[model samples]
Target: MKEITRIIAFYETLKRKADVACALAMVVYVEGSSYRRTGARMLVSEDGFWEGGISGGCLEGDALKKARMAILKSKPELVRYDTTKGDDNQIGVGLGCNGVIDVLFIPVDFENENNPIEILKKSFENNNKPLVVITNSLKEPELLGKLFYFESKQSIDFLKNHLDVGLFSEEILALEKSKNYNIDNELRLFVEILPKPITVYLFGNQYDIYPLIELLKMLYWEVRIVSEPNKIQNRENLTIIAPSDFSENLLNKNSAALLMSHSLEIDKKNLRKLTTSTVKYIGMLGPKTRSERILNELAAEGTKIDSNKIFAPTGLDLGASTPEEIALSIVAELKAVFSGRNGGFLRERELPINERNQEIFKFN
Candidate 1:
């Protein structure tokens, strides 16, 4: 998964910054079905530190215990988890959902030159991209890792060195675009580079935006506060703008705009501009009736607005009363839209439990 690649990148940065040695576990294959796919990685440290995951739940505890053992033993290992019912209840894992998973525990001492993981990780960091790591070609039809960069001539050589086979750049490019590669009898990994953080534009200096802005910063979102000259405070990632000072062309595709202006003229002007722009989400803080009145006034003045693109009441029905709670509710709605989730209750609905949860894939 790409998240795995990001975690590895963070590790690479950590090791360089703090001089800490780390280890990794790789999930190579699955029999039947598994919660996590092959190529899922878990990083563990000698000091009982850990980050990331291998299987959904079946492999974490064992992987951590074994990884700590690997740190003590100074050896790598290949481990398997069987979900089949066993004689002793404690002997093996019971997934409740059935499946068998095979994971390769590759321990890397960041200080060791012979470590394949360290080399592979370095390749990714140097290139500012993702590297594919192939595990098994026989008895497993899989590949793992994120596509860090587009397929390049250097990647062919990189693959040849790591996988022992000369894969062409054309196929690798195709695999990078697809985000997944099906290599015959091989465990394939394609790692993608991380994108920039999403930008949120808050178009008001109201007190409601304070907690919301704080919440956005807490989630590491890039926030720009578009407000009157004196209204803007000294805050990181914040910009104050007068009515005439706003720029329409510089908005990024992942940018979202919220119009919480207490002034009608300011709200109307921004609404007209944002309605015609490429912002993914344009939320206005008000009741549905107020929103309709604004739209009707705009329509009378010969401007068209897409109803689906605007969120009038601007949050999920979470019964929020406080500014912080309301901010949470709005963020929940934004997250659901960003992640392509339905934003519905699991217990009240008949959706499959797995579907309700954030699962990667479902074979059945």
Candidate 2:
């Protein structure tokens, strides 16, 4: 979700600089194992330019057609694509794509009043701000509505309804303390209190770290560059340290570590302390042979490395070479892991290609 926001901001900025029109599409609901779900976005420009995606190739063709219509009419509409029918040649917007998806296409011009992504982007820029998505559930599927309620640390205001002010406030409170809350009922009017950005610990000052930081920054990640002691600090948000300087107290309150230091000894030393910590991710960047060696060495020293907890050879094997390319591959792998997507190709795996169904979304 955070990455999507950043990408929207980037596109919005580009649109402003280039004076281009862009339409934003979001998948508000999915009935079955569809390619994308609520919050999946695709931004299409006037000249057939696009960034982001709403679904796999299955529904994009239909979306492209609607995007052109939205641009021509300058009025957006809620669209649906149903693939429940087994027929592959079914036409029309609601024809199932072997699954059903409800999408809302909103034409957003930087100068328009209906530019929600841009407004949402502005709200997200301030870490302490909170916003509510007032979706209308009275309709079939869901409608994201033209109104959005937002409250920064300073003010609380509504774009549409003022009667449900109390309900909106309670939702804001829920989002403020959003440790774990079931948000099914709050689909349309889902309130997201923008909390602090997630912290990412990049454990290395190698040549690769530069591009990694750049990519992560573009994704709105709160990155901390951890380098060896006496290492000249270059980045603004960096922490220099010796091998022993690593401490639990130093880890961010909700940080995930990326082990790209390329030093097996330093990596193992930190892993010893981190294995028992509460870090969300500890991705080791290396080949399978080196990763196995580190695991064996940790085991030899009595460190019980949980197989499920570690992501070795961190990032997908996209045959990355240059630093920029490597960073993209690593970010893609991290996103897959975070989103519970198998990094392996769908055709290569025996599991169903679409597992975002109700059966799989269930998590303990």
Candidate 3:
């Protein structure tokens, strides 16, 4: 999310100067292990200036050359890099990543609304829900590099006559993550799902909240404060709301709340309101006993709290003692929770680190 935001900002700057000659390189498919997964993108200009990355710096130099070539030829090109080979001159030589990645470089057409960057910008404009992008990668020159953005059933219905509606609808419904689809050996489509940014609600006015806010901002997540607006500095992606005005309507499934006001009354009041919310993750700052007591009090008052969603004595046990270290621990735990992961040592995990629903569909 952060990388795409930077790419868009850079593209806008270039647009302002009337220098929109560039190419967008995106990792559309990956097999085995990769440093960056599908949907990772980089923008390259004719003069070799670039932003974002598709690899761990090993593939960017070569991707830059390929992107410039695509720009010059005014065509879309799919370049595959197999890192499993041990050849010294190979692109992934020494990385030992043991992956095959397919990158799509599309020359940007500023005049076309269906261009890659324009489609991406459209996705950002309405990010309250997931946006599905279909990129044609093979065979048809007119369709190649063209992007289809689907955020509504109306949009899907509009394309029913032109596409395999059944296959596309099934794939979109079953898409938990991004993948490439091969259609009867005639067409290849990269179906990318772009999710909305995570939102964090900090229900406190304490000084310790600043560190966590900074970390969330770095990740490009939205941060909101449910306390005194004047207590914190106003900045981008940060919203300040008064306690009286804070309501459950401001939260969604992608939202998390951290109660760190250091006051028992404030935490209890906020927790009560959050229990009635659809927000899944709620963290309370303090000792286990205190949080438990607060929950017990709430329970006695006819409020049933979801124990699974509550993280009392919030944050992973990182042996943190200082404010900054505690903030790091909290943010780390939040990431793990949202990603459906346990905050444990990565070396202890048996499966692949980036493994998920990665199955590819072949439609007839």
TM-score list, all predictions: 0.71, 0.60, 0.93
* Candidate 2 structure quality by residue, lDDT tens digits, 1-364: 5646655766767666766777777665566667665567788777777777888666777787788787777765677677776555653335444566767777776665447666666666655465444334443333444534355322334322333445545555555322112224333443444445667788877778888887887777777766664564474565555556667566643577888877898888778877877776778887889989989998988888767768887777889988888788888877676656878877797876654433211111
Error of 3 at 175 (Å): 2.4
Top-down TM-score ranking:
3, 1, 2
What do the candidate models score in CA lDDT, each in turn?
0.64, 0.65, 0.83
lDDT of 1 at 94: 56
Q: Highest lDDT: which candidate?
A: 3
Residue 304, model 3, lDDT:
86
Instruction: Tell me how far the alpha carbon of residue 90 in candidate 3 is from the true structure, in angstroms, after superposition.
Output: 2.8
Better of 2 and 3 by lDDT: 3
In candidate 3 the C-alpha lDDT for residue 144 amounts to 67
Error of 3 at 287 (Å): 0.9
As for lDDT, the candidate ahead, 1 or 2, is: 2
User: Model 3 RMSD to the real structure?
Assistant: 2.3
Please give me the total number of clashing residue pairs in predicted model 1: 20
lDDT of 1 by residue, 1-364 (tens): 2454566676777568655555677665565556775556778876666777876665677788878776676665566677755645532455564666666666566676636455555554564344544433344323222223434676556445334333445444444221333444244443333333577888998788989888887776777888776776655556666667777765756788888887777788889988767777888887788877888899999998878768888889999999899899888887777656768886775654332112222111
Estimate the Cα RMSD of every predicted model relative to the unseen true structure. Answer: 5.9, 7.1, 2.3
Choose the strongest candidate by TM-score: 3
